[model samples]
Target: MPHSPDDFAPYAHTSLPRLLTTAHLLSGAPGDHREPTELVRRTLVRVCARWRRIPRDDVDFYVRRFLVKEYLRGSRGRARRAKAQRAVLVLLHWEGLREAEIAQLLGWSAGAVRSRARRGLAVHGDDAEHLRGLFAKAATGLVPLDVQLDAVEQRGRALRRRRRGAVAAVCALLLVPGIVFGGNRFMTGGSTDGSGGGAADVAQSPTRIVAPGERVDAVPGAQVWLTTDGKHWSTPEAPNQFLGLTDASAEDTYRNKYQDKYKDGYGSGRKVSVESGKPTVSVQPDPLNNTSYFLSGLYRGLSADPARVEVTVDDHRITGTVLTLAGSPGWGVWYARAPLSPEELKASSVDGGPTVTVYDAAGKAVARGGAAE
Candidate 1:
């Protein structure tokens, strides 16, 4: 049995195998099980740690539902591997290992192993028959299981080599046009040299000017700042900057230095009001889990009064509620609570970074954040 949240807290790190086994049992297979288990475990830990703030009922539902959705989405790729698995099944059976032993070795339950074997036998009847004969011969001291396994491995390698060659041929074919176009451009010196010489160069040069205070062209959506002296640079700030508390203890030191530099209503005077009449929404994104989401903002807005606010991270709307806090004018901060699927977190936009967007109840844009390397 799985431990309760409190009992499991200390053992969270060590219970990974149990979590994996639970996920496998629930999903009927361990397909992509390792990653999902880790994600769920981390989400549970965070949720349990903040149990006082999160609604227990919602947390329970969210955890299970999120896992199911992610598992289903992940299984699409596994469907393609069914053919390869059929071949593996024949090879495994020919090694004289019983079905139970195969189940244990593969980390699958007995029922799943039996189901896979039956389905595999149906799909590869001839292969199974041939393999069975080979196994019988081996049992009678006529051949060896290791030799059969070796032959299977060799055939698999040959298939892979053929696939690789085909892919190379396709890539070469696609590169032909690009190669010709580049060659033509290089020979004609058409915009190839930085110095403009062609008739078109004069037309383009005037449009591109390097000027003082001009922003440099950076990767799209990147945040860059410039200082006049080129000595120290800071992160680009919005018109009304709200400095993040990197180290809460250092707040006083920063306030002392810059507090008097700006006007009386400069820093803390710009208030982000969470009106009682307006609904409050919060969002949080967990780096550990691939999930980023929002919560309670919509419901709060509806219950209190009709209002519009948009939350955004890097200009993308969060999909679900991850965290919520309570207080007047919403003195709480929400985070992306649902774990991100591994693939979602790993995926990058054309600019090669994660883009996040948040919107308020009125579908207006609020916050945007992104990371790139």
Candidate 2:
């Protein structure tokens, strides 16, 4: 039986913003307008098709799981850490889900959830609350409700038509003698990955942008690859390393709204500096690769010439990769994976984190900040 458009409109109207926000965070590109909207639209179309059949108490959970699966589908080429970090962060912070619930949703053990959540929170403390505020502020200018509802209806209708056509084709084939269809092998929407949503498809890669007539030089034996656009990149070792990029805008907006919040000595422990073209640094553990941590941040407001960013992890200095996109995106992405042992991670938890320094082409240190203990 088919569900009516009227039946789903009310729920969609109320839930769309949060759903959109979740999708934005999970997609690892909150600043990119199209990816988040497209993700929510696809997930909602799926929900609208089966709205009546879903249990009322479980609708929110079901929709979140569905949205996660949809994100994983297109994220086949991403590294395991990239995928796991996003899932754990959004579920723990944004959705207010516990470790056990997130375990069931992602097919991981409760211990795994606890371990990752603890490590993630160690670095991204209070980020979710600030991010939610910025997203809510941005949602004030979204399109009218009727237009959004109509779009969902049209997509739902198209989906049903295709499903009916597939059924008819299957039935027509069934008429042949001695023919049998087995398992979900004949099903059109079966999981592309063999793990049944536990992993991603091996055939597809994350979407990369390459401008025509532009020459791109490949970095020899590089673990990370950046597109010519500079706005996007891929980390094969820990795909979720890039997830930190999603929080950039939210952090910036929060600083603007509370420009004088930390000027007094009351909250001296936390460092909140306004953007004055100086480099910022964020370091967090890679859940999938336990021995390594991701170090990344924006390098805007620096000299237009090539700049060198370096990080001193307990006196071991490493040169970082800095990406400045074409058309002057104001800020560019800079990152490096610092090797850390269990002993070091434990010690760093007590001491401060790494020290990051940015130097221009002239070898002069321009900006410096870190989790100074």
Candidate 2 structure quality by residue, lDDT tens digits, 73-180: 745544666677767877887678987567655645566787877776666564757655654555555543222778887887788778889999988887554235
What do the candidate models score in CA lDDT, each in turn?
Answer: 0.34, 0.54
Please list the residue runs of candidate 1 whose C-alpha ends up more than 4 Å from where it truly belongs after superposition: 1-318, 322-324, 328-331, 337-344, 349-352
**lDDT tens per residue, model 1, 1-373:** 2224353344433444433443443333334445545445444434344333333323333333233333334444667356334423533564444654444333334456677777766754747776566444433421111112233334434555676799999999989987976675545543312233533321111111222122222211111112111101112221111122122222233334445432231122111223454433322122222243211111222232211222233334333222122121222222222333434433432343333333333333344333321
Evaluated against the true structure, the overall lDDT of model 2 is: 0.54
Per candidate, the number of residue pairs that clash is 32, 2
Residue 53, model 2: Cα distance from true site in angstroms: 3.0
